[model samples]
Target: MVQLWKLVLLCGLLAGTSASLLDIRGNDVLRRLISGLERGLDTFDSTIEIIFQNLKTELESRCSDEVVEQQETENFLEQLISRIFQVVSRLTGVRIRNVQVPDITFEATSENSANVSIPITADVTVSLPFLGEIVDLDLNVDLQTTVSIETDTDDPQVVVGECTNNPESISLTVLHSRFGLLNDVVDIGVNLARRVVSSVVEGELCPRFRELLESLDAECVEKLIGESQDTTQQEPEGRR
Candidate 1:
């Protein structure tokens, strides 16, 4: 009986030892798996942070580039206005005292996936000095022009003498009285307006003013003046 009891106790001890070993092995495996999962989570967090930083940098760069480009465009437009004034003055045979660009606006709208429409509004002022005994009269005119740019085409079409927004054109009329001659300055004012409009359309300065001059009715005025002068000269000569 004693031997049988001892044998049973030995068997029980062996079974307990095997169960404890299995428990220790299972705990070690669980700890290793938890550590590996933590490491994986940290790596994922680092990757996400890197991606976010890169995205932020890219956005900043794009925004900065846009700002610089806008400033450059504004400068170029100011220069263009100055050049236009130079051309108009030469064409009109007048000395432009100053050229001012009061306002410049650029608006862009997306029409579709492929096309965008950009409208530019420029408010310009041209000052012309008094010429040929025209005293106490300063010729300063304000012109508001709006130009459209179609992004789909390579060459943009410019329409002059027609305001896209307003049917009525902005114009200045001048009347001059000199030396009892009673000459009208209607053609001069019209010529100046036409010259400015043409400059805007051509987008550059041209040496000759023939295009704008030919469009005016200056020849009719000259013919009437010439006939009057000839009649006056003949009458005075016959009397003498």
Candidate 2:
């Protein structure tokens, strides 16, 4: 009975040992599969991170370039206005004490280029002591007038001459005339204003005025102005 009991006990121990070894093998396979899945997930996460980082860097670079380009464009427009004023003053035989750019804007036609436009307003004050000397002139004559400025590249001389001759191109209000000669003073102011504004418009659109403008750091303005002047100069000189 004792020997039989010993054999049964031994068999039981062997069975338990075999079951434990199988369980260990199964656990090792499960661990290996889980590790492989984790490694794949880690690689995928790293790739996604790299892609996002690259996109972010590209966007920042593009935005920065755009900002710099916009700034340069604004500077160019400002210089253009300054050059126009300088050339105008030279042509009109007037002292432009101040030239101001009130507003400037641009419209983008493509990623690399834009069209810039500016609106200019000027205040002209003239001194007419000669008008005060005219004792017979009517002081109460209504002297308010309206003025318009036009820019043309073609046939600039004709356009400028027309503007100078047109009474409507310059508007003036006789605020006060010295020595009570309001009519003479008003006339002087009108003539001065017309001459100055017309000269400026002509200079801005004339090819001959490009050298003077380029000296003012307005290369872009000169280019556009030159194109217009060339077209106008090509027409028959007497056609206008």
Model 2 lDDT per residue over 1-240, tens place:
579989868766744553354334334433443343334322423443343344334323432324553332233333444454443333332334344544333233322223333344444444322222211111111111111122344422211112122335334444444434233334544455554444334433222222222222223333334444455567798973
**Which parts of model 2 have CA positions greater than 4 angstroms off?**
1-93, 106-117, 128-176, 205-240
| Backbone clash tally (model 2) | 2
Worst 10 residues of 1 by lDDT: 109-118
Which structure among the candidates has the greatest lDDT? 2
Q: Which lDDT value does model 2 have at 220?
A: 39
TM-score, each model?
0.30, 0.32
Tell me how far the alpha carbon of residue 71 in candidate 1 is from the true structure, in angstroms, after superposition.
Answer: 9.9
lDDT of 1 by residue, 24-114 (tens): 4334433443343434322423443343344334323432324553332233333344554444444433334344444322221221111
lDDT of 1 at 157: 31
